[model samples]
Target: MNVSEPDSSFALVREFILLGFSCEWKIQILLFLLFTTTYALTITGNGAIVCALWCDQRLHIPMYIFLGSFSFLEICYVSSTVPKMLVNFLSDKTISFAGCFLQFYFFFSLGTSECFLLAIMAFDRYLAICCPLHYPNIMTGHLCTKMVITCWVCGFLWFLIPIVLISRMPFCGPNIIDHVVCDPGPLFALVCASAPTIQLLCYTLSSLVIFGNFLFILGSYTLVLLAVLSMPSAIGRHKAFSTCGSHLAVVSLFYGSLMVMYVSPGLGHSARIQKVTTSFYAMVTPLFNPLIYSLRNKEIKAALRKVLGSFNII
Candidate 1:
């Protein structure tokens, strides 16, 4: 018998074809308009927050500083996914493997950073309300800067090992990613080989970051609520309610969707349902943030009025 060396090279998939939401022509048209409008609003809303915080001196406190950084993050965060989604709504949504990996990396990193930033924000509120006497010292400029840097650094670094490992896997099978964004679960599922080790590691790390930061935010807010209830003036109580209510709403939207997605590997949701769920948090949340914080809070409203008043629009 003729001796044949084992086939050394495996057929590799060069790109992934993303089967986004609906296949109907009418529905796709509607979705295209919907996603386009949503992206515009996300950019405008977050950009406004960032500019307001930067230009106004009065809103330069620790709370606003963190908010500015968060708004900037939101801009980057939504941009990482929405543009591709917009284009996909109209035509074939094919992305190269390298492009898909970059999307996954930025998307995860920014989302994780948001979780940590939200916790830091809650801690800031707790100290301001419960430990007023020491709040200034506890949250100085340097410390706030440190917290921001840590969030960015840790967020970008958190999933590096898992992503690199996943990317290196042999994706020599099906090339269809059955969702809107470049999610890790879908990407991993396409590999020619099973990756129990990488899967376990990624899931464990994701759960830790999500639940750990969420719990910290909850604890901080509980103490803040207690301190707010003990405050003597009704005006002070109303102010706290306004700020805390907005924050709680944002937190719930973010974590609720995240838990459903990442609590287990895939949870067996259909592709359409997954797309809608992902869009709710990833695309819609950023649009709502500026509306919630600026329009509801009397302080932010006043600051915006002061700044915009010079143009006489208000």
Candidate 2:
């Protein structure tokens, strides 16, 4: 695996061949159609949520603000990889070295931001459910905006050092990436040197982002659950559960797949498993977010109706 000696200069790698799937033409066609439909629905679903949040004045509160921001993030997140994957299925799979790293940076950055945002969203729900009296004063418009901005900034900056370190490591011939996306594991495997330090850094950051946010979310929801259970009225309990249910489901879908892929990177999983797991979070989760949030929550559903109705009339 070592491509360079201690004193040797790093070799320049111009491009990478993405061996997306080693399947037949028919299988590729089937997968292409399946992913195309999934991507279309994902965009439409997440886009509707974003539009609904914008057009409806009723959803202008802190909760919906976070939800809208997350929906928008989902659109960007899925866009970072799915388009290239679809193209790879049909045509040349070659991606320039810069293009690969750019994809790597954005994909990981956006995903990191998602982890932060999800944690923040869970905290928002906790405040709303557990501290109803102080919720409005605590989560003001200004604070919500600040939190959203912080998430984006921190997310984009999270993997800067690791990406730089890994990018500098020389890549040898047979410059091929096994996975659909320019993921860290596959990218690491391509490295010409035994970059233990860089590999550790990447995995550490991934673990911290995934596990740290997950723990924060878990703690927030635990308190929320306790508060909800103690509510005096049965109707109050049901309402509280209903509001938190969608978020919990989304969190489950997101963090569950992430932990499996990242927490133990390149452990026992094969390339196919990695692709499937990554697709679940990258493609499937985005498609489900709007549905999960909209179906379970009356406000989101109503907002969608309002947005769609206006469109219909026009």
Candidate 3:
């Protein structure tokens, strides 16, 4: 039945029941343990990256700054949803209207910022690799800071209108979101009215952020690839590929799942596929990002070791 305020003329849902993983109690416990461990590791790994970058003077350059910002974003991204998810695993899976929208906003906004930052990072690498002589003059410290700020501002603003519109829409009873998070799909399904305009707007915004940034990253890396290939020294080529490799891996992990979820939803995929894909991009990617960067990057490893040694933890 519809659950609206007594004073309201129309019926509306005040809280949403997030239908998180339909499993037995034992499975829920196991999943909670798994997610809790994952969340802890994700936070620790990304936090370490930020600290390493902040403490190391050698890493105070544009590339490392971008890395630090991205790592911080990962921490925020995972935190925005994981804590509530962990709570729901052992407790009630219900979320108030305001809380649900807040989660939805932060999660998508942070994700959008990540996409922009990734593309910006690719551009930075492209400039550094392809135009080494002018790289210093081009990517200045002031400019790098500006770009990072722009990524965050744009990301946060991009979905504001769409989310506001969606939140204002009437949500009738049986307010059950099928997936784990307050995703647009499940929320859209719960809307009492046929909100085609709002749905289209959300899809458009998501597509623009996901596809637009993906294409930009692709183009930047394509130029980087050509520049690396044309280098006379094999060492130079290997170094170029090595620097770009981690970024590419992250891009693949993030965009692959995103395309499956947003860009091509009509691929006859199942809800399980959707959940798994979301889990990969949302939680798994953040956990793996620090490992991918630190393992592949000698500088990052050195910095991390330095940080650890200073604390006598290594």
Residue-by-residue lDDT tens digits, candidate 3, 55-150: 999999999999999999999999998998889899999999999999999999999999999999999999999899999999999999999999
The stretch of ten residues in a row with the least summed lDDT in candidate 2 is 2-11
lDDT of each: 0.87, 0.92, 0.91
CA deviation > 4 Å runs, candidate 2: 1-11
Query: In terms of TM-score, how similar is model 1 to the real structure?
Result: 0.94
* Candidate 1 residue spans exceeding 4 A from truth: 1-9, 306-314
Q: Which ten-residue region of model 3 has the weakest summed lDDT?
A: 3-12
Cα RMSD of predicted structure 3: 3.1
Candidate 2 per-residue lDDT over residues 1-314, each given as its tens digit = 86755544545679999898879989999999999999999999999999999998888999999999999999999999999999999999999999999999999999999999999999999999988899999999999999999999999999999998888877876688989889888888887778888888888999999999999999999999999889999999998898889899999999999999999865879999998999899899999999999999888888888888888943
Error of 1 at 14 (Å): 1.2
lDDT of 1 at 33: 93
Worst 10 residues of 1 by lDDT: 5-14
Cα displacement (angstroms), candidate 2, residue 16, comes to 0.4
Better of 1 and 2 by TM-score: 2
lDDT at 30, model 3: 98
